[model samples]
Target chain A: MKLLRIYRALLTAQLQATAQYRAQAFLYVLFSVIRPIVFLAAWVAVANARGGSVGSFDVADFAGYFIALTLVSHLCMSWFAWEFEQDVAQGNLSPRLLRPLHPIHYAAAANISYKIVTSIGLLPILLLVAVSFHARFQTTLEHLLLFIPSMILAAVLSFLFDWVQASTAFWITRSSQVSFVLGRVSFIFGGQIAPLALLPGVLGTIAYALPFGYMLAVPADILRGGVDPARGLLLVGAQALWVLLFYAALQRVWRAGVREYSAVGA
Target chain B: MNAPVFVRDLAKSYRVHEREEGLGAAMRALVKRRYRDVRAVDGITFEIGEGEVVGFLGPNGAGKTTTLKMLAGLLYPTSGEATVLGHTPWLRESRFLTQITLLMGNRSQLVWDIPAADSFRVLQQIYEIGESDYRVRLDELSDLLDLGPLLHKPVRQLSLGERMKVEFAASLVHAPRVIFLDEPTIGLDVTAQTRIRRFVADYNRRTGATILLTSHYMDDVVALCRRVLVIHHGKLLYDGGLADLATRMAPYKLVVVTLADGASPRFDEFGEVVASEEGRTTVRVPRESAAERTAAIIRAFEQQVVDLSVEDPPIEEVIDRVFSGERPLSQVRS
Candidate 1:
């Protein structure tokens, strides 16, 4: 309860600070939308070339998948990796370490505040795109309900997973290179480049095997509806497992990272 | 445990990567980097009774800040132990943290883009300050620090001195009982520095907070700290009253004599002439012989000698000599 209050206060401060950059926030949301739209347009062109259908997707299905991808991507996003690198390098982490709370609370609050403030603009833009593209999304009450826990679990899992990667800044000077490479890896294997089902051969298998797929593609796939019941259960279970794993991993990494911090200098 | 702060042989060392300045050396370092251990805080120990403000004096890279960081729980000690308010500092329990604060002049805990009050609210939550207590404490701090006019301004918009005042209020919102201040007056104008020093003295008196402060300015030390811990190269060289440090490090006493007229009385024979003028002359004499020399000079020029006063060299000079290794550690360690 105390931690929640702290988070709320921190979140409030973050909101007020971020609100000053409303134009920049809108621009950032616009830029975030461009990627999915580009993917949607290219996939639509590919489907039209093949008699208006490819595998299990047509123009409308492609639009639905990509639009859902946009919303799902926004739901679980965080930026502590880049920020953490600067904090570690510039010794800004010193002030944070002085606080009673773990520094992660600050990052988490900032992440949530930025999302909440920007989503006001984001949701409207997404709705306009969905209508313009004639996107079709079908889901049952159960599927829609399942999407909530799955997305929440993915959000927590991906946050910690990325946070663990960012914590490498404590050990190595150029730790961002790890985050940088893993970023592209997550983009490809996490189903941002293409849906896991549409990937050919081993690529699809690799996507499912890695945690990245659960982060983006799995929750998104469930939201698009029409998945085998057993697979949905399996995906949600994997998402929960990843959350626990990263939770434990984050604890260990944070301890060792703090120890490593003393070793380095500050 | 009886003291508010205690440390036993506390030491901190860091293994830093070293590389030579050459493309070839850089490539070689990539394959096999050389590491050097910096004993930033060597085996040093001291205890502060409750409410005692001790000035931590050292030159650049002298481990003052490093020791403060360790005691404040920002860095773990490489070896040894420290207990602040009876809690092991490095453990960083919330109970322990709420009772302490480490303020760095070069760093800030306040959120940059927001008004300091907003940041203070966040801190208040973190420390679990109650509503009434928070309001009362902030009111007091505003009065003490002149923060009323500045609290609503964004931290980035405040002047350096104004920001520092607000910074003081932010760090103290928890009413930390143990405060570690690293160079609290650095980069501030003399008037601002005096205000901060005065505020610290007044705050310490009222709250009985144990403060360990590091500052380059001697005026800060002279004004606020009666007791000082002088360290060099991560080792404690002297720890005692400020006057004692000057006396021990600098073993000479300066005697200034004001003469009425024609008062030249072989001042060179008594000691080195530090300064000379038509009616005044200052001489540096060995500490042991200073009194005798002053008496003899007065007797020789009884009619001419109008006034005489003996004093130790300035504290900065003493500190400089210490850092310059004029006196060996074993000889000067108090």
Candidate 2:
């Protein structure tokens, strides 16, 4: 209970910090919203140009998928790689380690808070994109109910995956290059750039099994009415499995990483 | 009775990769790395009692901070055992953590770009302090540290000293029973250093909080700690009262004599003359022989003496002597 309270406090403090730099925060949200909107437009052009449908997705279906994709991607994005680099360079990680709460909680809380504040602008932008594309969305009570759990699980899985990547800071002095490569891979394989079904057969199969797809693609697929109810349940199960697996990996990396931290310089 | 902050033969050594000059060496290091053991904290044992403010004194890289890190549970000792407050430090149980706080000078735990009051509120949540208790302690710290005006300003806008005062306040909101202060007054001006010193003294007096402080400044040790544990090359050298350290390491007093006329006095018979200037002479005499030397110097200057005084050597000189291994306390006393 105390740990939970501390997480709340850390989250609140991060939100206030983000608020203090309103111009930067505003620009960040704008950039985040613009990137997805552009992708939505490109996919719309492709679907329309290709005779109004690609595979099972029409232009409306593309719109729905991209809109949900934007939301999930925004909520799940983890900046821990950059954050860890700065903290290590500046010796700020020392104080965090001194705290009773696991340092991951601090990272997780800040990420969650930033996502919540950024999502305010994001939701409306997503709605605007959906309206422009005349997307067909499922607003059934059941789907809406499932969306909550799915999004939550997606966020956790994303955070854990990024955390394991960030923990590479222990062995490698510069993990930014690694992070960049992982990010590019995630963009292609996690269905951020396009729906998994749109990819070639072998790549699509690989994407479905990898942890990357469970982070954003699975959640987005559930929301876009791309999957039937049975498959939706299966996707949820896949997300849960990845969450557990990634969480375990996260713990292992954290334990080893702290031992490897040199706590160098001043 | 409280359990000792025990450590039985604790050690921490790092296998640092050795890199030589030249591109070839760098490339070779990437594949078949050469490693050297940097024993930061060698096997040592000591225990600190509850509520004892012990100063951990050492020059840079003397393993003071390394040991403190181990005790704070930030690092795992390579070998041996260390239990703080009856709990293994590296395990970092929340109960043990709630009773301790670590403050590194010029390093902030408070949120940047926000008012310090907001950071305090965040700490309130982090430590799970009741609202009433938080407010009470906030008001008390504000009054004590003169934090009223600084509370509402963004942390970046505050001066270094102002920021440190707020940092100290933030660390104390939980009223921790044990505090580890690593150069807590570092990078601060004299006025700010004095203010923090006073604050630390008052806090310890009021709450009886155990403090382990590290600083390069000897003045800080003199002003705040009656007992200090000195470490050199990762080895414990001396652990006792500050005055005892000075007395043990330095057994000589300096005597300066000024002649009434513009003439240098010959005091070689009295002691070893260290310096001589116009109408003045300085000499070092054994502490045991100081009184006798002073009388002899007085007799010699009876017709021409203007002024004379005797004092112990500066603490820094004594510390230098100790570091140089010139005067181990045992040898000095013998």
Candidate 3:
């Protein structure tokens, strides 16, 4: 109970801090919205070039898919790798290590707070895109119930994966480069380039096999009614499994990272 | 019961990469680098009983901060055994951590963009301090430090002195039993430094907490710490009372003489002339000969000797001699 209160306090402080930089926060939301809109535009054009349908998706389907993708990705994204590297290199981790609280809570609180605070701006943009593009989304009571759990699981899975990657800083001085590589891989496999259905058959299968699709594509697909109840359950199971695996990985990485940190000095 | 803090042969070393200047050497180093072990805290042993305030004195790179980090559980000793409150510091168990705090003057743990008061609240939650207890402690700290209206300002907006006060307060929200302070007054003005020093003394007295403070200012040591540990080149040169360290390192007495008006007398024959001004001369002489030197000066100019006084050299000078290798380390006395 006490730890939860501490986490909430940290989260609230992070939200307040983020509010101080209004202009940067605006830019953050704008740029994040712009990327998926561009991808949505390309797919819409493709469906138009094909006279209303391309690879089982119409222009409306593309619109719904892309909008949902934008929302899910924004909610689940983790920028911890860069932040972690800066914290380690600048010796900012020293004060944190001295505190009794586990430092991961600080990072988790900040990440969650940023997402929640930015979602206010994001929701309006998502609505604007939905209206302007005439996107048609289909949903049911079952999908709504599953969507909440899927979104939460996706967030945990993404954060843990990024945290594990960020822990490479303990062993390598240039962990930022490693983070960049991992981020690029996530971008490609997490359905940023295109919906998994439209991706090459083999690549789509590979995306489903890995944890990337579970982070973005699965939640978005569920929200758009592209998944049936049976598949939705399977997706939720997969997300839970990935969450466990990545959580284990994070524990291992953090232990090694702390040992390296102490050995190397602050 | 064991001491609150104890160490046995605590040491730490780092493997540093070596490379020569030039593109060729850098390129070669990338292929194969040579590494050397730099011992930051060579084998040193010490102990501190509960409620003791010990000052750690050293020049830069003398491993004062490194030893503090080890004791605070922020660093693992390369080879040694250390315990704080009967718990191994490096393990960092919650039971041990809840009873200790570490404050670095140069760094801060507060959220930078928010008000420091908000950060204090966050600390209250983190340490699980009860509402009434938190309020009482905060009120006491605020009154002690004269933190009026500074807590509401954003941390980045606060001056260095104010921010340091907030940092100090935030670290103590839990009323830690053992506190590690690393240069708690590094860059403060004279008044601010004095405020922090007085606060430290008062807090120690009130709580009976064990404090290990490291500072470059000698006054900080003289005012708060009876015992001090002096380190040089990663070695413990002395560990004893501050006054004893001074007496052992500086076995000389400073004599200031004010000659009679219009009568200048030669004082170099008696001792080393540290300074000479209009009719007033300050001389430094061996402790054993200070009396003889003063008597000889009075006899030489019975009418010219207006005033004379003998005193120990300043602590700064004694520390300077120790750092400059003027006084051999083996001469240290406990």
lDDT of all predictions: 0.88, 0.82, 0.88
Candidate 1: tens digits of C-alpha lDDT, residues A146-247: 899999998898789879988999987788888889889998998888888899999998888899988888888888784765688889999999999999
The prediction achieving the highest DockQ against the true structure is 1
TM accuracy, model 2: 0.93
| Top-scoring candidate (TM-score) | 1
lDDT of 3 by residue, B1-334 (tens): 2999999999999778898899999999988999999999999999999999999999988999889988988877899899999999888888888899989888878998999888887888878889999989999999999887988999999999999998898888799999999899989999999999999999999999999999999999999999999999888998999878768889899998898774556788989999888888889999889899889888888877878899889999999998998887788645
Q: lDDT by residue for model 3 over A1-266, one digit each (tens)?
A: 88889987887789899888888878999999999899889988888998988888898888898899999998898888888787776678888887788888888888888888788899999999999999978888899899999999999999898888888977777788987887788787888888888788698888999899999999999998888978998999999999999999888888877867743333
- Ordered from best to worst DockQ, the candidate numbers read 1, 3, 2
Angstrom error of the Cα, residue A154, model 3: value is: 0.8
Clashing pairs in 2: none
Residue-level lDDT of model 2, residues B197-302, one tens digit each, is 8898888888888888998777787888988887777777777887787677788889988887778857888888988999888899999999998998888779
Estimated TM-score per prediction?
0.97, 0.93, 0.96
In candidate 1, what are the lDDT values of residues B1-334, reduced to their tens digit?
6799898899999898999898999999979989999999899989999999999999998999889888888788889988999999888888898899998988877888999988988998888899999999999999988888799998889999999999899889999999999898888999999999999999999999999999999999999999999989999988899889988888899999998874565688889998888778889999999899988887878888788899898899888988998777787899
RMSD of each: 1.6, 2.5, 1.8
- Residue A172 local lDDT, model 2: 77
Model 3, residue B214: C-alpha shift (Å): 0.6
